[model samples]
Target: MQDNLPIRKIIHVDMDAFYASVEQMDNPELKGKPIAVGGGGARGVVSAASYEARKFGVRSALSGAQARRNCPELIFVKPRFDRYHEISKQIRAIFYDYTDLVEPLSLDEAYLDVTQNKKGNPSASLIAKEIRERIFKEVGLTASAGISINKFVAKVASDYNKPNGQKTVNPEEVLAFLEALDIRKFYGVGKVTTEKMYQLGIFTGKDLKQKSLEYLDTNFGKSGRFYYYIVRGIHTSEVRPKRTRKSLAAERTFNENLSSEIFMLEKLEHIAQEVSRRLTKSKVSGKTITLKIKYSDFTLQTRSKTLPYFISDKSIILETAKDLLFQEKLQNSVRLLGISLSNLNTEKTKKKLEEKKAVSVQLQFEF
Candidate 1:
């Protein structure tokens, strides 16, 4: 079975508590102590927590007040996104030194396909180790890595050993490793799906593999096919080198919910401007504009408009957002307002240019 599988070397690299670790690395006093990166305010949520903070049950998305309750000594440091981006670029440079087939999942993690690495090294595990060492030595941050035959197992393996460590799942070990893995740990399976799987008596990869293709499809839909193959260690998704941004967005959660429609419209204007600025900075526009609203009671709603053409103009975005905002009556007092642009034109321009070049080449040949 292993001999029939196509050979590929995939590595998933994830930084250990990225934001909090960066804080500790820069501040001498924060080392060896529990720290969190976010505002420690009434409505503030923890963005990242150091391992020390994690020991006390403080974690990302936990409210700042709750995080403090978890660890009385937890220190909150405001996030430095600019600094993090700088460090992320440095880490990517290291990845590029090894392989151009690097797919960044976020500012702190990425997938690297080193089957044909620039370093001419055949061992993916060794390349992962070298990448981690370079990141620590150059950027003063530690990264954990998972090496496997495919991205699914590689991503799962990466988290098996966290905080400055690496794990490798060789082709021969893929089946055994996946069979023993908890069903909840399967990629793309979330909380609701896990509960559903448990109700269906699917508790592990072995149990999942026992389900027929038609049975999985009937139960889980299209994702059932994903599970069907992934359980057998078959994932053919390649590491995309230039993954385009699907959307550009900006949103704000207010300190106080506003009941006034005027206030909401005013907030939407600012949000639209922010989204437009991001679209311009990214040099991409989109046809779909979505307005996300979160009410005081925490219930969320979204309204969207897909235009005939892509646009990054702030005025147009603001007008469209205003239309969406006023088109519906207020469901409740709003606490958060967000504007996002999607269905981006990142590849459209490239495709158009390629067509123009093709026409030019054809004309030259005719002459």
Candidate 2:
């Protein structure tokens, strides 16, 4: 642990194959069977897969056809978002019984700051155990957890013992635990970043720590500094109870590819209206507008423009989207179109600025 930073007890709870688990729970016939939640068509993708399917190398984001090829007995079930949300609410209610400082990452996972919890239990490990037990007993579903001194470490630890298990990284073991971990195991390091890290000879956390901050910055830009600090156990992100919205978007996938620009323009107008309605409902406006285009070949491209002022009006959004659409030529027939607004007028952005400034100041006094 860094000398200047105070220790915090954070717990990350992730449900076991949440979407597929819900389907199995509702239908006894699906229990112990390989199942996937999504359409089984040429354009369909898997949202979630049961453990049985995962054993056959079937996973989320895989094409439905590929999933079936991987597991010939894979059962396809349509997703029931409303039912999932209902169960998620019940699980959150259980979390509140122990700590009000719950920050949900998604419907299936959350981080709880148990340093000062309602339970007043000194052991975060015990609290995590009790919470998981209650969730399983009440909801008839299992969850995994990772308890540590910060959000990043806790999040990574939660995956160590998955499918109804937990792992706690004590303060004394923090440095060693990180040093031995595979570079791919780091929370924010995805496939592309992992390949980049491998090319840089960074195979483990220890290898990453040996690189100078400047070297990382030169290679990974803003994210380089993030990797430098996180490897040294210096992540300071807090569990925000009400996580602010960063962006809002609306998109549509056509039943058939549209080749004409005029047809695409008409589709963009409706997407802009949906984005405008969403912004108004959230009572927030944004200065940045982005147009997303997906070709029939499944290639994606985006164009963005930032205005001097925020806007929530459909007319402005449509005009901006139209300008972007015309700015580029159609590379192939269009299969999907989307519009999004960012740089939102929210407290999260302001808080991030303040946090960045504080970190800069702290760096001068620390290593």
Scored by Cα lDDT, where does model 1 land? 0.92
Could you say which candidate leads in lDDT? Answer: 2
lDDT of each: 0.92, 0.94
- Candidates' TM-scores? 0.93, 0.88
* Candidate 1, 57-81: lDDT as tens digits: 9999898999989999999999999
- Per-residue error for 200 in candidate 1, Å, reads 1.3
Question: Residue 245 CA error for candidate 1 (Å)?
Answer: 2.0
Error of 1 at 89 (Å): 0.4
> Which regions of candidate 2 are displaced past 4 Å?
265-270, 306-319, 346-367
Clash pairs (backbone) in predicted model 2:
none
Deviation from native of the Cα of residue 109 in model 2, angstroms: 1.0
Inter-residue clash pairs, candidate 1? none
